[model samples]
Target: MIRPGLTVKLSLLLACIGVIASGATGYYAYRANRNMLVNEAELSLLTSTELLGQRFSTSIDDVGADALVLASLPSTAEVAQSDDGLRRNSAREQLANVYSSFMVHHPEYLQIRLITREHHGLELVRFDRDADGLVRVKGDNLQEKGQFAYVFDTLTFSPGRIYTSPIAVNHEYGTHAAEGKPTLRLGTPVSNAQGAVVGVVVIDIDLEGLFKRLQNDLPSDYRVYLANEWGDFLVHPDASKAFGFDRGRRVLMQDSFSVTKPLFAQVQSEVRVNGLARPKQAAGQVLAFVRRPFGDSEGNRFIVIGLAKPLDDVLSGATLLGNRIVRMVLVFSVLALFLAILFARALTKPLHSLAYAATHLFAGHAMETLPLDRTDEIGLLARCFDRLRREIRLQMDALHTKQRELAHLATHDALTELPNRVLFLEKLERAIEEATQRQEGLAVLFVDLDRFKQINDQFGHAIGDKVLVAVARRLKQVLSSADVVARLGGDEFIVLIEGQRSADGASAIAARVVNALNEELSVDGQSMTVGASIGISQFPDDSGTAEELLLNADAAMYAAKADGRSAYLRYHDVLEARRREQAEQAERARAGEGATAGREAEPTA
Candidate 1:
């Protein structure tokens, strides 16, 4: 055989190296792409899980509010107090109608009952939804429930406070539709005029029904999981796994998903797991879990909400890319072998460019332009990277949305959704700066609710909360949209009015607030009224600083209260009187000092 030239030998050697290198790169790229896709899917699933938890909390609150409303009704209390038979009967009938109305509106409600603290927690009036519709049960049919936790635990609470019972299978006799079904009980104490807890208004929620509704909008493929504080699965895609503890043997989530053990211990608020990590329960899947507070209590009562998606679904794009990469490797090997003799040096630039882009793909900057216009394998790789960038940006946008929601929650009150002190001060400082620059003035109104404490004491904190919500709503209604209103803790709210620093202008706004609060209010069918005492202070005229302006307004508000409840006072009015008294005291001191000096100058020993 004739010996090949040196150039031919070099070409064959370079060709063999190119084939191996292309295959190795393809394998690694496939692995990296799979990881990236899994990460994005995990983040997305985690956000969705958190959102579901919030929705569940909101639903619980709604149920609690309904229970509170029933408990607060005067008729419910009247029946519970054991009044005259005729009067009690009338009240029961009227209240039963209201209960039926609620049941009609809320399909998820299994039963609504007023259980009296007396007669061993006898059900005074009850409405249960059966196979047909709402059925009213009364008289001898009303069963004693005092032995149940929902009744005794709720009666222990003060008026207006809600009690959320642990979710369980309802085994109560004569429960009709709720019998042997997963139930969540929300109860509030019903207090008579004497502020005695006479009865408990308890609403039985169909736990599965409620979650079904909550998850209606979720994708069909996504699986949901719920575990109680003990990690007992309360909800699972496979119904057989849920409520396993009720069946005797406990199936704990921590045991299934080992990584979730910290959640039960309150060590981690959230956790994400994937099949690649080889967590047994999460095999072939991606799962995200968030620990959510179960009730309004400060206790350790909580639930873990989780969402899972198939790993195969997450890797579908990666699979497609892998196939494309395999083909590209095969085509590029041939091209490399042909070009190796003359263009070996040219291949280094594209390979280096691809490597740099891959390394810095997530460094928070765009990759320097890639050679995407070329029809070669390098261009195909560049195009895949560009697509990957778009997918990442979409995931980032979702993360940004969740971040904004978290920031808003941090700055705003959870109850009233009004700006908290920190956020209010920030806004005030900005407003002050703007007003100073524009050479304009603004007004700050400090408002204190009168008789609120008395109402809170009589009704219980649950009703007190509703009263505050009502007050917040009224305040918003009284002020223009341009004005800012914030709750400064209990029974105190502050308002900022731009271009209204004049005494007349500020007083007019304050007057509107007082009048709005003074109007008779009806909550839960109980009539009550509250008054407002407002103190006004003007920016630039009162004080340039936000803190001083707030202090002056506070001082003026006290003056308003001193004058009488349901009144308004200006800071300047209070300041002028204080200034006169201070000046008189200074003059008197000077005169006394002069007299003392003259006596000393007489040299009388």
Candidate 2:
């Protein structure tokens, strides 16, 4: 190979440097965006999984409550007890009619039976809902189920106590729709007049039906997975994978999702995994798993519920970003090569330093550092560069000022002139940190406007917007200047009260807010009457984190609405009601844990 000239070598070196810089910057940018997308997908999946688990728990609790209700009825005990002739027959008929009504209302209930404790667990009344309609199995058809766990296990419990059977495929002979379907059995012992465990009332819940309703609102791209405590798959995306144990083979969740081993080991209650991080296992998928307790204080039983989405779906935005980055790198590389060739050819002995200074001047060197004293052609060029730098600095300053203005607009609401959700959350986080350091208390008030949607639909959004602005103003006027009042979005506002404040103090603030918004507002000659429901939650009292605090406050706000509009409720009161409900279940649940009622927030105006 012929040795190249100094100019050619220098040009090649400069060109290679420029290409590497562009390629490295593009690569890092692409990676950062990809990682961010994956992280957000993981968080979203986890939230969906948690919500689904809560729903499943709630459904199971409802079924258990129904079983208890039937057991408590006097007619069930009369039918189950050993009695003479017409009276027992009439009681059986009455109870059967009730079971039929339940079947009609809940298509998911495959069978409801009242089994006697005296006749070796003989079925006294039974109603089954098959494909055609509700069928009451009578006479010889009502078989004895003394050996089954749902009967024998339930009869051992005291009155009001619920027995939850393990999930399994129903294989009992003469069963209607429940036969061959995955079923969950809930049973409660029926007591006589003297409060003795005389019989058991059982309800067979179709597992597939319960899950179908729970997953109805989820996105179509989502895949649901469920497994027992033993890691055996009960429900999977692939039908063949589900109930594999019944088919004489075993398909385990932990075996498929290696990251889920921690869940089986009881090391972690929740796990999030993405295919991009580990392509060999969950290839092209992002998954979240949560371990939820399945039974009412029985056997310490739990189930793993998971949701998965396609990696391609989650990374769609990142893919677009990567393509843009690739184009930018290519253009920069070509431009750098052309400029390197020209610079190499033009640089002479004296001009080389000048060229180097020109290249680095924009990189953050002072224009005064250039050789302006030399009265030559190079000096003239240096002076020109100095002048150009000054002009660019002024333009940069103006650009920075514009950027700050845009940032303010992004964080604050244009309609209300108050902090928006994004800014409010940031401030809440900072306040929480300060409160924790100072060992002080803080509170968050979640305010929701009642009847705002009706007004918006009747009049127009313009008037509704005016009402929102008015509401925001009144909220600010009601709260002290030290407190932060923010409009979270249409018909909803949030307040952050920092410093030491008792629950009573927060309630006082909430009451003032409710009264303020409850007043009639005349917006553009239209008299609009709006009421406020405020929920208050305190830091370190209701929750320690910002997200939990907001959620608690939101829950309390709904309770206020439920009590009656234009009222305020503390988050502590919501917890108190839940505590009372759970206390009632304490007799039935050994763990003293039961389903807490949930309320949905109203749609934004």
Candidate 3:
């Protein structure tokens, strides 16, 4: 017969092994199921993104093709030449009939027109959309759009090439009939028989209708967002935030999700972990974004589109599987608990001493003297457990330390100990929200150190780093308690100033910042002088959102640099107009040069 001690040990060992093996199997299954669910979700979202992009491309293609057809019509060109009244009248009637018939079939076509470049983009023939519906605009009702990008930009493009305007708040004087309507302008050059571009056939698209087509067949739970090349929200689930440029503000994806910076930077196709949040009633999400390249461009480049959805919707079946596995594991655990209790009772007398020591040891209190002198199995087990507890405590302390370091690194620059881009954006967003609630104003300053690159080249990187640290310290010294400063990498920095009641307060703060940077300073005994170019964009004056404010400030900073370095420039609407006109003029010059070269190459005709 086996000894009683040997039998008890063998039986308990087998029971423990069985429980562990069952747990490991359950754990492995749970992990496998979860991994499978995550993979399925990624694939599903990616597929949906592909569908969304294709649908949008089709819509754009249809619009582009329509513009091209209208532009190519012989009657469309007749509206440009006023020398023949009878011919122009007949062309107008034909064009009006064609436009009216097409608008009926495509209700999203808000307006269609033939505009002549003769009188600075004067509308020659027109149809405008209003609350009542599509109405033909007669003489005097039509207005000049020479100042608009669509008219001016398309005038330079070769015949048959389509030009698109940036999506914006429809602020046309007559569009008061549909005030605040978001619109997109598509135009194709109208050329005469000689191929000389004389005018443009333009179309205005209702943005909401365009979005409706994109949303078609999408799940009800999904929220859609569309940003321009600059990351301004052209379309967002939040109606108020979309087309924020009309309100003199910006709502950018990069401000909300820093990981999405790549989408704009490199025109990347996809980015995971861009930041995910769901409505209260919705399940948790793991948002993934897919960038769709636009067929046409607003200015210099095409736009990148993004889409996101909840994980639960993507992996509906796996959630149920997870719940069932959890239930089965609980039942097995109950059975194992019963077996453990029976096992403990069989060895109770011998285990009593060790259990007493273990209970006090785990509770983190001192234990009474143990029977160490007995030299029995219980005593050996007690000694082993005490040593294990000491080792665990040491490891726990190390883990805690590492966790603290990681948390610190997440929000701060390791070298300067200043807030990084991610943390700065979060703080700025929060500050904007708070300012909105308090009905106060906020300002964002985009600061670029003047000639810091020369210093970096003169002194080694070690000294360059020291100079940055010194600059951070100086910025902190000049800032008020309500201000936040962050390095946006390289020599660029941003400052967020709050509690300002007007733009003047922000201006005062900016002046102080300029003065601070002007002070003499040295890093590592290497004397260096670095001033800053600051751009000021304020809430309610320049922009309504943090992202918009930052963008405006950046634009203003470039203006300051253009004017002269080491000064601040406040954002102005005229600044944007000047920039657009400059870009369009440059494009026009290039086109003219290419055309001249092509003509020169042509043999005597």
Candidate 4:
């Protein structure tokens, strides 16, 4: 290197002053910006976590509706009080159908069960939707679950309230449920007609599915995490780290996110704002979280749901703007060497303003946009960042709206908003599974509106459509919310009655169905009464398969039409046996007639 002269020394001195002044200014500006960004981030994260917690709580409350529905059913009452095996079996089977339908609409459920108070906690019915499909574990496969806290503890609870268990990695055996699933068990006491505690119905919700749904609408950059009251990671971005107990290891959220350790101490639910240190990763990592102390009436926390977004993603532009400001200060200092300090001061003020503006990303204000009128690179960079941040927010909102619509349209019926056939069958299969597990009987009533075609012909399709809608409304009025009433197609509806009940109980429901449809309808100011022909089939007494059960019910409905146009018929094995006997007798008579004719025609007998 050559030796420097006076001019070079002067230039070097100006550059050093510019660098030191700008560096000091940038340091303080960055600190203030980082702190501001962190505060905003904390607020945003805390708000999000609170909203998500409330959402989860709302979902559980909806599930509580399912529990109450199960508790109030007369079939559930039968399962508790009836002495007849067929009646009890039928009621248990019907209860299973109700649970299955509930699970169909709620895919997040892993298992829905009604456990009897007797037999070491005998599962009256359990519908476990496993990989194979909905499976009804029965006999040896259905274990005595009374010893479990969900079963035994719920028995002491009030009939209407739900008792939730600590979320844990599921260790359910047999029936081949998905291993290592994060499950939350909810139980409510089922009472007989006399209000005596009969059994406990428990719903095992798939926590992974539930949380994944909660996080799906969120920005892709956001990190969603969940831990139990004890801080075990129920859900984490890293699939391998989640439910660590299943892998014979402990992965506590407190250990993973150190700042969250104090959260467990707070009695009331709280959203904790934190700037955390991640030793293995970036040292600048910050986290904002909420600790929702969720539990049943028995006491304190059952689990915690948390949401976190990295400060790095939200304040990415801060780093770029800081760099640009430093560069601009140096260039100006070199050019205006005599006025270096004043030049640095002028630019530093704007840079600090940019820093302050960047910190308010969460502030929803148009004025919050930084001054972008400069003719230089710093102004351009700031403008671009502001636009980018706004675009991200808009995109997130659009994504959430679309996702919700798609999710709704996928499972519900378009016409009546009831569950479609696909969902109906899922419910049916679950009911079958539960009935099978409990060795209970259930009934599937196939209701076909008599002269529905005549009504459609007399009235236009629009009137016919209105009639169908009215019919759906009427069916709903008679049936409990726990019952599964689905429209299979035009003029056809399927109702699954779960739990143990006698043939008379099914017949009575079928009669009710026919009576429900007998009402006069005023469609376009025209009065028309549509009668129904209902066919009923009971579990264990009827054939298994969805097709077979429907076939049997359909066959019985045809028989009911033959007996009378507006009537209901209970399926019986004797009907099929009688038809077989009559056919055999006819064949014998034809053979005898053919023999007599042949003998007369023949020259030799």
Q: Which candidate tops TM-score?
A: 2
TM-score of each: 0.55, 0.56, 0.52, 0.49
Tens digits of per-residue lDDT, candidate 4, 175-210, equal 346456777787889887667887887888887788
By TM-score, the better pick of 1 and 4 is 1
Name the lDDT value of residue 238 in candidate 2. 96
lDDT of 1 at 196: 85
lDDT of 2 by residue, 373-438 (tens): 879887888888887877888999999999999998999999999999999999999998998898
Pairs that collide in candidate 3 are 250-548
Name the TM-score of candidate 3. Answer: 0.52
Give one digit per residue, the lDDT tens place, for model 1 in 157-209: 98767788877889988898899888888888999888989988989999889
Please give the lDDT score at residue 476 for candidate 1. 97
Which digits, one per residue and each the tens of the lDDT, describe model 3 over residues 473-532?
999998876678888888888988878434557667777878888777788776778888
The lDDT for every candidate, in the order shown, is 0.87, 0.86, 0.76, 0.75
Model 2, global lDDT: 0.86
- Candidate 3 Cα deviation (angstroms), residue 417: 60
Model 3 lDDT, residue 477, Cα: 91
